[model samples]
Target: TPTTIPYVYAAEEDRCAPRHDVLIPSRMRFTGSTSFSVNVFNISLAGFACDALLQIHRGTRCWLTLPGLGALEASVVHHNNEGLGCAFENMLNPAVLDRYVAHYPVPETEELEA
Candidate 1:
């Protein structure tokens, strides 16, 4: 089993609203309104650590897409009062991940893991 890595970072003073996107996957069930709040936090070459406000249970398989990055499949690996944590089902888009890394460079040390 892939190890679940806890995201380690400081919460921004401003809520830094997460970008929302509509997702339509044929494999998954959905109602009239289907969307999820995606937080792009602590992104790395391996994967990104995000918190999602989704009505999905753990182990649920779904596809995710960001503004610059295209759609990719993912599985629900973690869920808590905070939100959901999912390891990208595949290696992240390197180009997109690189851009994010350039923008939100990791600090010298990891902040308290959330």
Candidate 2:
């Protein structure tokens, strides 16, 4: 029988605000550089996690352009094979974040039906 290893979250996880999983298509640009399209996997009032192909290192600052919300400044805190985690310079309003997440878009095909 194969044994499974339990996943352990980092100590920093305790300091983070509650996060909500959402698939919001967005763009990210390194400070003073061209923007690259990326997918925001999850978000919270504090910050967001995105999947990007660029080699963004920890402590790098960037801007995230969310679908409904405008650009917001953030700093990279960590990165792994999956993607990078960032912390917002200014926290987002909880109400606004909830609204956006609740109404996150559906595929065009699905939208057409509704």
Give the candidate number with the greatest lDDT.
2
C-alpha local distance difference test of each model:
0.47, 0.75
Candidate 2 lDDT, tens digit per residue, 32-56? 8998888887788777778875566
- For every candidate, C-alpha RMSD to the true structure in Å: 10.8, 8.3
How high is each candidate's TM-score? Answer: 0.52, 0.75
Superposition error at 75 for model 2 (Å): 0.2
Predicted candidate 1 versus true structure: per-residue lDDT over 2-108, tens digit per residue: 87543221112222224222121112222334655565554444334465655566556666666555566666655666555455556565666555655554343
Best of the candidates, TM-score: 2
User: What 10-residue stretch in candidate 2 is worst by lDDT?
Assistant: 4-13
Candidate 2 wrong stretches, greater than 4 Å: 1-13, 105-114
